[model samples]
Target: MQLEIISRLPSTKSTKPPILCIHGAYNRAWCWDKYFLPYFAQAGYPAYALSLRGHGNSAGANRLYWASLADYVHDVAQVSQNLAQPPILIGHSMGGMIVQKYWEAHHSHPAAILMASVPPCGLWSPSIYLACQDPELLWQLNLIQFFGLRFVTPSLLKKALFSEPTTAEIIQNYLAQLQPESQRVILDMLWLDLPTLHSQPTSPLLVLGAANDKVFPQFLVNWTAKIYDTQAHIFPNMAHTMMLEPAWQKVADYILSWLQERKL
Candidate 1:
């Protein structure tokens, strides 16, 4: 149960609620450390990102295949509970669904941000969409679940994650860090662990998506927002991994502005 939580604190203390970022499938907490943690910390919010039990430097990699969505939710609950104050939860992709599950279970966070998150209905729609729209990419992604990084290539990675062509170094670096996601968690997200609308929280919510995200298309993002009675802001020319994109600052700035508007 020793999850890895990476944190960055601002030089000047502020009253803003700490921000906790959750990464998507095939990703770890380090995904946030490169840009988000520092950006938010510099903005005076204590930013933290935690690797789920089997990801990053966290323990339980040996048991990754059996890790369930509930287990991932437990990890998030543990970290957020240990924070000084209730955190503003920001989750991307699968992590976003995790945030939804967390809120449905605890309903204690100050606010929640869902970026390129899966819709409450589940990943079935996207799976179908990808199956038709880009079968190779979908096939590669499935192969990755069992084969890990060996099945990934710069071209496929770019197609799956980025709208614009990324540098070779960046692609290699990400490839090196990418890990196989849990099949059990994937199955849960595909259907088993969907959030309950009846238990939805009343706290503020923000839904964001990339205009060019192939994984969770803009329509799904809109659907996710609509389900929560909110609107989604889709960034043009961005892909699934918005935080690591070239214009990542735009996404960061947008989130910062939203947080400021709420006076969080």
Candidate 2:
């Protein structure tokens, strides 16, 4: 339940609520601290990133393999409970699925941002596509997460996460920071723990995707947006890890603009 916060309160104490960023599988709050947290904070809105129960510096690292998707939801809910008010939830990949589940259980947020997220349907489509097109990449991912080792080569990492302009040094640093995720969460994504599509929340949703994202392509992002009756803004020449990409500032700027337009 630990949080990494970047606070920049205005002299008069602005009325804007903070943003809570939730990281995806194999990642932690540090993912947001790298760019989004500071960028948003500099824009006059406090931002926070949460380390789920077993990820990063949070507790329950030893119990990761046995932790269920519900456990992840509880982690998010607990963090929400501690906030002054329900913060705008910005979730990435598996974290997006967690946000969806959180909404189903308790729809209490100003808005939600789903970035390169897993679709509500499930992980089956993406898994099958990767297995067919690049089985080796999928195999390496499994090796890294399930076996608690890093098996990803630089080429594969670039193919799956980054775009052409990304430097090798950035890729190396990010790869080094990658951690193992819960096996139960992986299994749940494939089948058991998909989000509830029936009771979808009507909160303002901003769905953003990258054109070059090999994991969740534009089509998948559009599908999620369509379900919520919105259009997706696809960033060109970017990949799955858009937030950490070289042009991350553009993404942050767009989100800031959207928040202003919606008055959230």
Candidate 3:
């Protein structure tokens, strides 16, 4: 597991606790580096992004196709344990699911944030909803899930993750860095890897969603928040990749405000 540390000063001198950002499927720590890592670091919080095994420059890239969700959780757990103090875990999409699993296994973080997270019930609800709402889009995602990178099309990618305000250059850069995710992990999301919700999480949790997110839309995000007894905030005019979306700073500001409100 490779931890991409974004620190301006020594951790001991920071006013806020470190933040550990976990990227979603087909993404790595590099995605966080683009906006989140720097934003949080500049906000006076030390930040670190973890490249789960087989993703980004992390070890085992060659065997990623066969890796499971549990394996990804292990990567997160390792990074969490190595941190100087429990970090505020922030995860998006599949990474959010991974954070849920980590919290279930070890409730060490002071707080957690789920951005366009996979629902606690698992991928079935979102999958079924997308299938019903947009069969054509679902079909394209299915193609990518099973067949990998070649199945992806620029138009589909843009519609799936971005909105009208996002420029072509940003979308192109994101696509160029996007890689094929593990089929095994996708399968786990669909079936084998549902997060346990029986035990209420001890840490304060913030659940966020984008109004235009194709994958985990508002309905699913709200459902996720309901299970945790928290509110799901839906940002208008944004899509799945909120961190990289044109209005990314808005999301960052909200998170910072939330942290301050909670006194974390």
Candidate 4:
């Protein structure tokens, strides 16, 4: 399968392992291009982001709705295999869950970072949490899943993604790039496909979350960290889409520091 792999390299090559970023549902590799790819690369780490099958410029759009979580995992594996060296995986939201499954299968990555990722228990807890905490946002997201961008508005999109003030223009730009994600993959995350905790990877792990994240709340982030036996870091006043927020550099810098400390 043809995949879109967007890359950025530092002017002076370093021995740092390449960083492969995985985007979440409704987003593609371009989501990382705006901030993460360049930021990581500038810090002397080669950075790349892949548009999962049916997302961004990747192939299989016609079969997107039928794509399963396993298919997404395979896509990650395929990209990882072709890299010159094993990559340090960084995943956001649903993409974080994909990283977990990929690590479970291979267990060879240098490290893994989960940013506002779905919990290993799956989406049930967060789904129920959203239903109770902010039913309107949940309803709006459901509408977008079946109805697409027409159901999204600047205010609602901001509520779901950004806790910091963001201009309507930026919100609209992201809206234009948004696309329908696979229903099959959604179901897989909901119940069918989840990480196997019996054998965990020994690679260093970083679990990050936003205090204002409505989708995957701080509790879920804590749960994910607990399952992985690591501490969770919840940034104050941030939301689900940290990479696109006004304070995106804060998140990027934190990750860079973590990587440097581990010397990965």
Q: Is candidate 1 or candidate 4 better by lDDT?
A: 4
Residue 243 in model 1: lDDT:
85
Candidate 1 clashing pairs, residues 3+ apart or interchain: none
* Per-residue lDDT of 170 in model 4: 72
Arranged by TM-score with the best first, the candidates are 4, 1, 3, 2
Per-residue accuracy of model 4 over 1-264 as CA lDDT, tens digit each? 999999999989688899999999999998899888999999999999999999999999999999998999999999999988999999999999999888767878999999999899888899899999988888889998887778877788888988758767778888888888999988989889888788767999999999999999998999899999999999998899989988899999999999989988
Candidate with best lDDT = 4
Give the whole-model CA lDDT for all candidates, comma-separated. Answer: 0.91, 0.83, 0.86, 0.91
- For model 4 the local lDDT of residue 14 reads 88
Model 1 per-residue lDDT tens digits across residues 1-264: 899999999999888899999999988998898888999999999999999989999999999999999999999999999999989999999999999999867877989999999889888999999999999889998888877778888888888998675567777777888888899998999888888788556899999999999999999999999889999999998999988888889999999999899988
lDDT of 2 by residue, 1-264 (tens): 554333334345556877988889888777788788877877777677888877777888889888887898888888878877788999999988888888888777899999999988778888787788789887777777766755667787888899999999888877787777888888888889887678658788899999988888788899999987889999998899988898999999999999999987
Deviation in Å, model 1, residue 109 alpha carbon:
0.8
Per-residue error at 222 for model 3, in Å? 0.7
For residue 151, what is the lDDT in candidate 1?
81
Which of 1 and 3 is the better model by TM-score? 1
143-259 in candidate 3: lDDT tens per residue? Answer: 887777897777888989998899898888888888888988888888888786779899999999999999998988998999999888999999999899999999999999999
Tally clashing residue pairs in candidate 3. Answer: 0
TM-score of each: 0.97, 0.94, 0.95, 0.98
Q: Return whichever of 2 and 3 wins on lDDT.
A: 3
RMSD of 2: 1.8
Instruction: Rank candidates by lDDT, best first.
Output: 4, 1, 3, 2
